[model samples]
Every structure is written in structure tokens, then in C-alpha cells.
Target: MHPHSPDESPAPRPAGSPRSIDPRRLRADDLRYLLAVSRTGRLVTAADALGVDHTTVSRRVAALEKSIGLRLIERGPDGWTLTEIGRAISDSARVIEEAIDRVVDTVEGQDSLSLHGTVRVSAPDGFGTAFATPALVRVRRHHPQLQVELITATRQLALRPSGFDLAVVIGVPAGSRLVTEHLTDYTLGLYACDDYLAKYGRPKSLAELREHPLIFYIESMLQVGDLDIERHLPGMTPAFSSTNVFAQLEATQQGAGIGVLPAFLTQRTQLRRLLPDEIDIRLPITLAVRREAVTHAAVRALWAALRQEVAERADELLLE
Candidate 1:
């Protein structure tokens, strides 16, 4: 026979070895990168968000695609878009991330007050930072043994059960298992920066606001009020709009336009009440807690602290 070539002569296989192939290994980092791409929609954007270079993201994504044997993303003139496989992976990754966060929160909650376990609190983004955060600081001062975690997101925290020990929710609590505590009910009103007020003089009525530039909060769910303009204003074309209340407040402060803000947030800001006498948009505030967590020492402490804080500042927190 001719000299045996390596391809012509098969090497002995190990016992119980797969005759064909094995599934490729998947890693947490791969999942993270994939999720990042899904969120940002482009290699450059994803890389920047992850604090890596575009080429690195591109290379890692390519490797991940090969390992998984599927195309995860598609490129187009508009931007990078996720394929069905990519979307599925992203959803799975989010579940994994939330689970991991919950475990961490639980573990941290076990530490001493200085090292005490962490209590995650969620609220409307603006309210969390401006009001809830300061109140949290006060809570920490009183109970130095507990750690408080604050999560500020515009979206409702209904995705995962018990994701938070306590949440300062706007409107009524929906789930039956949740214990709802009424924090306060207040009206929403149009506000503009002092500078804007000085320049435009405040609009005296709904009809007058039609001529003024309008800034608006782009909430995922809009609950219009009884006032004619208040009900219609969000539907009206906005000159400036943002999902972030803080951004809206900043734009209003910079004299961009009038925005509807909770009376509590506006009270501390330099923005002046516009149409204060005419606009009456009521928004109810409630504190929600999982029934299981109500008796938790940390949760009860926070709930009591928040109640006292809001109670003491009720006049400033509510519309006159």
C-alpha cells in the first residue's frame, strides 16, 4: 500500500467518545455581550456601553455566533437589529441577570448594618433621586445596620416577583399579593423655569399655553386628568419630550418649555408654577410592598421612615 496519509488512516477514538460532535460551550460573558448588543443595537454603541472597543465587540460576537451556530444580529442602513435567535437570547439573559441580582441583594442583606444585607427600593426615576434618596439617607442615619439599595427606573417593576423589598409607586398597587400603603395624593401642574417665566410671563389659561413651547413627560402609560388641557396636553405635539422626568425638569429649568411635574418634585426646583390656579391634574402616590417583606425589619424601617417624611412635608409635597 502507498504510505498511509493522515486523512486516509483514522486515529483510534477514545472510549465512549462522541462519533460526530458535541454542543459548544456558552459563557456568561458571551450572554452579556449579546444582551448588550441587543440593548444598544450597534457594535460601536454596545462596545462603548460595555467600555470596550468596537472591534472587540465585533470579534466576540462573531465568535459567539460561530459557537452557537446561529446568526444573532442583522445589519442595515438604519442600524443593527436583533434576529429571532438574538431576541430569545436577550430575554434569557435578562432573566439570568435578575436572578443573579436577587441573590446578591439577599446575601448583602445578611451583612451587619454597616455590612448589613441590602434592601432594594424602586421608584419613578425622578422621585427616587430627588425625594426617595434623601429619605433613604435619613433612614440610614437612623438604622446604620441596614444597607439600602435604590433602583430608579421609568418602567414599572412588575417584571419579577419580590424584585424589590419596597417601591414608591405612582397610582394604586395592582397585584393582590402586594400590600399598598397610601403615601400621598397630589395634583400635577405645569411648571417652567424662573427664567422662562420671566421671559414668557406665565400662561394664564389652557388656551394661552397653545402659543407657548411645550415640554412633556413621555410616560409609557399616560393617565390624563379631568382638566381639558391637562387631558389633551400630552396628546398635543410637544416641542421637547423625554421619558426621564429629570430631563423634562432640566429642560423646563433651562427655559425650554412648560412641563407637567408632580408638585413634590417642582417644589424644590427653581421652576415656577404656571397656570397654578387653573391646572388641576391629580396623581395618587402609593408605597407598595410584597406581603412577605412587610414584616422584614429593613422594609418596615424604610416604610415607617418614608411615611414620616412625607407626612411632615405634606404641604410641600401636595398641591395647595
Candidate 2:
């Protein structure tokens, strides 16, 4: 693919342009522009992070590439993406940023270097509130300038994940480009409100449980294979369905039907677990990050905070 500089729509130069870069002419500081573009994936957003105008961001990045005699970034359908070499340069930029942060700490004392820029996180509704929220909030405590945006949804992750710096997904995807690791294992079990069981009569067995209506995700639209009800309960279908887990929970609370919900979600609710031995369905939650994004201080800190939260909340995730 031909690389297009985001700064300008230019006329093609003559063939055999020299690709050699002069080390003396290279401006190391301009690497900051490249790092900003890598983080935001657009000239305008990067400019916003740096407190500069979009055109100036473009100009500085262009100058940096010219000094190196290589195309570091190229425009794509959504925004700008880094080339292979550009990713390497971003790593170097991260090191420089770390050093700068260290220098700030030396000058101003510990926890003084406030990490700047926004870090976006994509997660499920329940996990977003229960786990990702508190963890990201702690990151803000350390680096007050860092911004965290959490997008909550229960759907399949995009093939080429763009806006978000981190993704917490339901299962380990088969063919995903992002770096993934097992975040935690959580169980889903049959749950019913006290009123529902009181009125409709509690089921003693799996067969009896299937007799009542079930409240769950819309089967047709559910992209998460791990949440498939059929895999856990054979010959069972949801009587009421919604795309959102919270909606399903609310429906279950209204005594609409029994819900197959995460154990963590029902902690404070009146929902009572049913047939724990027979109805428990365990699933894995995975954390994914872009290849180039892991180097950023904010991203690394976010993951670290998230991991610690999960570890500390082990009892909540997996009830004994």
C-alpha cells in the first residue's frame, strides 16, 4: 500500500528519490508528534492532546519524517496508522517519555509526573462498572492529567480495534490481531428473584428449571459464543431477551424469568443462586491490547491497575 502523509496531499516526486537519512539533521524531539499520532490515530486528536493546532501537528510530523527520509505514518479509512518502522520509532519515543517522566519525578518528588493524554477502554457493561471503572479511577489518582474513556457493550470485538487502547472481551478469540491474555475466570449460574421462586415455585432439578421462562441475551444478535445458553442448557430458550445484560437482569428482578447471570453481578442483588452444582457455567475473560500501545505509560498503568483489581477481587469473581 502506498503511504500518504497526513500533512499534505502532494504531487508524486520523481523516481529514485534518496531514502538515506542524515542523523545530524534528525530532530529527536519531533518524535513526540509521532507518538501523539500513534496514540490518537489522527492528526486532529493528537493535536488536541499536545495543545497545538492540527496543521502544526501535521507539519511537525512531516518534518520528522523528512529528516528520517521515511514515511512513518499513512492515512487510512478511519485515521492515520503507523508503518512497520514507525512502530519501532514509537517504542523509542516511549522510552524518551519514560525518561522525561523520571526526570520530572526527580524534580518534583514521587507521583508528580502526571501522564497526559486520553486512554480509551472497551469493556462489557457488568465488568466495566465492577472492575474496569475502579481500576481506571485509581490510575487517575496517580496521574491526574490522564483521561480514561470506558465504552461498555456486550458484543464481538472489532477485527481491527481502533479507538480504544485496551479491550476486555468475554472469550479468547480465535484469530485476533491484538495481544491477549486470560484476565480471569468467572462463572454464570441460574438465578431467580425470591418473589419469582415464591410465586412460580422453585425448581428442584435442571429439567424442572427449564419449565419456567428464562431471561437472557437475544440469542440471534448475541455475538459472544461463550454466552450461548444452548451450550449450557439443552432444549432451553429464553422467554424474554434483550441486547444488554442489565436489561436482562432487570427483567429477571421483575420476576419475568430466571436469569443466567455472572456471579459477580448478583452480589448485592436479591437474586438467589439456583442449582449451583448443576447450572454453573464457567467462562474466561480476556484482556487485549494493541501491539504498539502496550508501551505507553498510561496503557501499562491501566493494565497494571486492572490486573491488581481482579486479583484482589478473586472471591467476588469466583465464589467458593
Candidate 3:
């Protein structure tokens, strides 16, 4: 008798042989192609990023659109414009990318000491340089193996479903999809250098501040939150407007004006509090992270460390 062959004998079907392949299923390459196109805005550029020929990109994109039964891109004189569905797909692809990163990190043991990757953090330029940078120093003392990339900009960096691992944002996060953790409560207090205080004396009341050269953060230049300075100090207007808190702080140090600074960033400075007994302007500081990125052990550890640091230093942070 001939040797039994597995393929020669018909095996019973598992009762699902006629099931059709889902037409809407998206492949990794499809998302990669779509995201590349969105980023580069040209088929040739996208193809370069993907290390493929322009024709390959075109063909694959056509295949993806056909598979999904939607026209994703509209070619026009303005180059390539994404259709409504294209924009939606690009957004969804970003979420998938983050989730994939988390999965890879998990599989690679992100919590292990061998875990080494750069965690990008976005923060306001002034706060990042003066305050958050020091906090990173403390974090490094504990986890020397880890690396952090701090992007300090006056404007909010492009974040969320596209870029950045975490962002230290002021005030409550708007979107429900984001994972926001309360970092600390910030209390804005009027402060001036010792010399300034000596020259002008401390402002005992809101009216007293009018005589002092009042420095304030210019509302138009702020990136993170609303400038509610008027709410805190009724009828109070500034003599000097600055786009940066650190600039205002420096100006206050030189006796230029009374500056309103977050207590956390000002505690170590030579600047003395004005009207310490009766002034209070507190806002909640929250750390916002993309929900999909939270599953990565490195991201989780960094976030946990940040929250713990904030909590540990809450009293100092709040100036309570």
C-alpha cells in the first residue's frame, strides 16, 4: 500500500469553509501607505519614505481604496487632497500605530532594566526649561537606563493620535479619548525680587498692585491654558506683557514688575511672595497621554513616576 498522505485524503471541513474573507480588513501595509501619503502629501515622497517606487505606492493605494470601497484621495491641481473618508482613515491609522507600538513594547519587556527607549515629552518652553527639566533630572537619578526627549516650545507641539508620548498640559483635557492624570494643582501668586518688594513694598490688596509695575503673561501668546489673571486679581492690569513666564520672572527679579508665577517654578527663586496672606490662584495641572500609548510599560512607568513626583512635592508645588 502507498504511504498515507495527509493531502491525499480529504479532511472534514470545520463547518466554516464557505465563510468569505472580510473585505473591510485593513493590512499593515495599507495603513503605512495611507499615513505616509498623509505625511508627505505626494505619492513620490510617500514612496521614498516607504522605500518603494512611486508606481508601487499608487498601485497599493488604489488597492487599499478598492478594498475599502471608498475614494480616499482626490487628485487635483492643489496636489493630493484627502477625502473625508481619507482623513478618518488616517486618524484611525494613527490610533492603530500607537496600539502597535504598545504591543511591541509589551512583547519586548518594556518594564525590564534592559528596556531602553526614548520617551518624548512636550511642555511649554518656560516650564520645560526651568521646572520640568529639573524633574527629569530627578527621574534620571532613579532610572539612569531610560532616556527622555524634551521638546520645549512656546507653541503647543503637535500631539495626541499623531505625535509625542506625553504632554504636560495645564488645565483639564477636553477629549474623552485621552488619558489625563492630575499632576498637581498650581497656585499663581504675585511675586517680586527682594529689592522690588523693598522699593514698592508688598501689595496688601488688589488696589495696591496698580501702583507697582505689574508684569503679566500675555494672553495671546499662551499655549496651554486661558489667562485668567483678571479673574484672580479683579481690575488688575499689567504694566509689561510677556509671552513667557520665565521672562516675566526675570523681569520681576530685576524689579521691573510684579509677576504672577506658578508657585512650583518660583519656590527656589530669590523672588519673594507679595500679598502671601490673601492671594490665591490655583489651577489643576494634568498629564495628557494618548490612550493607546498607556499600555506600554515605559510610558506607564514614566507617567507613574511623574505623578508620584508631583504628589511627593505637592506641598511645595502648591506653596501651601
- TM-score per model over all chains: 0.59, 0.78, 0.64
Among residues 3 or more apart in sequence or in different chains, the pairs in candidate 1 whose N, CA or C atoms overlap within 3 Å are 108-117, 108-118, 109-117, 109-118, 110-117, 111-115, 111-116, 112-116, 113-145
Poorest lDDT segment (10 consecutive residues) of candidate 3:
1-10
Quickly count the clashes in candidate 1: 9
Worst-scoring 10-residue span by lDDT in model 1? 1-10
Ranking by TM-score: 2, 3, 1
lDDT of 2 by residue, 228-272 (tens): 888988789999999888898899899999998989999899999
Give the distance in Å from residue 57's predicted Cα in candidate 2 to where it truly belongs.
6.1
Q: Cα deviation in Å at residue 318, candidate 3?
A: 1.4
Clashes per candidate, residues 3 or more apart or on different chains:
9, 0, 0
* Candidate 1 residue-wise lDDT, 202-223, digit = tens: 7777788888888775533433
lDDT of each: 0.67, 0.82, 0.66
Scored against the true structure, residue 48 in model 1 reaches a CA lDDT of 73
lDDT of 3 at 93: 74
- Candidate ranking under lDDT, highest first, comes to 2, 1, 3
In model 2, the clashing pairs are none
User: lDDT (0-100) at residue 218 of candidate 1?
Assistant: 52
The sequence of per-residue lDDT tens digits that candidate 3 reaches over residues 53-74 is 9877777777676566556766
Candidate 3: stretches off by over 4 Å:
1-113, 116-118, 134-147, 153-162, 223-226
